[model samples]
Target: MNWRLIGACTLAFASVQFSPALGQTDIQSQRVQFARGASSATVKGTIKGYAIRDYVVGARAGQTMTVKLTTPNTANYFNVTPAGSDTAIFVGSTSGNSFRGTLPVSGDYTIRVYLMRSAARRNETANYALAIGVTGRPAAVAPKPSVDAVVPGTQFHAVTSIPCKAAPGQPTRQCKAGVIRSPGGEATVRITLPGGSERNIYFNNGNASSSDARTPKFSVTRDGDTSIVTVGAGERYEIPDMLVTGG
Candidate 1:
């Protein structure tokens, strides 16, 4: 069961000093008039009342934190200041009910949420539950791999490993190339693929391990009856079926 454990107090927002001391009591409406946003803590959704956390799970101090927000139809203000620092890192109006900022220092931060006016009902009550959290900045997202085309006439296939960063933009390959035979079982080599992916595998047109990202780097494409392979990008040809031909 996936459950969101709240680390701090569940008490109303107004109770916490410098947290989100604003007008309009914490209403029960849709739990803080939900608006969508992303922060170190959670994903896409309107957070009624929450805290800023790390963008990356279990992110430690010294990591940049990304904070985002959306307010839909209300005027509001939010700011974050690193612990022990007197100046707020980012402060501005919700441009079109949306806001975003990053925090540098690590520690307990004071995220103040201020409303334009005060209503008899306090801010904590559910007109909207503004959620804040701290998280590590997002790492580079890897590109999605395309579906591999199967060999036309047979279920069996072949592939060759390509280096990620080959000699100054050149792919990584065995310092010495040729019929690399494994002493007992299979021949394996350390090779990098097109996007700086490294893998060591006994490649010869075999099974699923062909594309195992960690290693076993091999080119695999099934475009009709022709299966091609080039270790140095058309410089060397890895015997398509070394097991059979021993080429």
Candidate 2:
């Protein structure tokens, strides 16, 4: 008479034992390779349920590494962990969607993409694209000559300095200074003030210019043999020769 109730209880016990929530599944990581002299790589995938994906890449120290993540789901993020360490080197949620900085150690790094804990429990799906770029170490640079000690026969070129009017109600004034040089060799521009402060900017392409939002505002532009520089308010500058020679 109790056979039907006993059978129901046995079926319920078997279902609990074979349930997916009560067991763990091992997920394997994928390896990523970069081409020679290549600075960037991208990985794309979809994440569903409690599954996670990982990518491993090798990098060198002193290299500038940058990462960017694009995803439709806000609850999906990634983690970057250095070799032999459990602590994440970079976490997407805490550090934002992009990371840019110099790497300290040379080794394989892991990039893990997964959903947030709540999202994982709900078995949500997320599609994402991850991009990484590594800029190799810069070439070895020779030290510059001392500022006080001048090299013999090194002539100083005269530059035209134009006073720049400050904005209305502004206290300090600025200037647009110009220097003429021969169109060859690497161009080095040095700005020296009366208080012994100096700022050096180098142009490898021989003729180039750059400007940023930093203040005191400054910019450099090279056209043929003439180099024009814009300096901040009330600062003096020294424009040396286009050719910089030293050990």
Candidate 3:
């Protein structure tokens, strides 16, 4: 188990006296080993809370990669990122749980699996089976999806930004984040930090928690229509009910 902290003071915040260690998630990585005369492999694992699992496989730049994730929990999704880059080529949360794409500049591609903040905060567990395959010769050109077409796995009901402070001692600014809600009104808030990493916060049954690996220590303050979330000692976020609940 190779465990690495996601990042410290993320969510585009720079810490002063107190660090934003809300969802300090730890990543557990495993390398995929293919049998002789085989190009595909299947692995099974279980994750609870804010734990993350990553599967790494080596492939040439032009090889095709196919990944399918089967899990009972709707909150569990995967992401594909090329080696040496933080930007994900495929985000399963938005693109669906299956990915078939041609590799670009790949040495080792990582497929990361995680639970949505809403479920992770409740100490939920997700058991999943991941099937990964690499095959096909390098093609002259990769297939591209048509623009303006309604793509599959587009999960957001609404997308917007909220007022936030970048860090302690910083002025209030509009920090963009993504919100997705289940039919039961539980919402997960995802914020992309600098360098493409993401921080997620969950609002479930009127309780709030972040996806950081560490146990969360924070406070919330209500003002008018906005609820201010303060993480650690000083990092603060102003979340409006309309943005979260469609009120």
Q: Report per-prediction Cα RMSD to one decimal.
A: 20.5, 24.0, 20.2
Best by TM-score: 3
TM-score of each: 0.28, 0.46, 0.48
lDDT of 2 by residue, 1-247 (tens): 1111222122211211111111133345998887786779998889886677888877753356788889998878877765434446467766677877544334677787777667767878889899988775521121121222221212112222222333333443333222112123333333332343333334334433321113446656554444455546433222322322211
What would you estimate as the lDDT of candidate 3?
0.63
Clash pairs (backbone) in predicted model 3? 23-211, 23-212, 24-212, 24-213, 25-213
| Cα error, candidate 3, residue 137 (Å) | 2.2
What local distance difference test score does each model get? 0.32, 0.49, 0.63
lDDT of 1: 0.32
Against the true structure, candidate 3 reaches a TM-score of: 0.48
**lDDT tens digits, residues 1-247, model 3?**
1112112212322212211112768788999989999999999999888889989988754467999999999988888876544557687877789998655433678899998787888878999999999996532222111122111223233445667664578777666564445445455555554344444556654345443313356677788766688766555677766656655
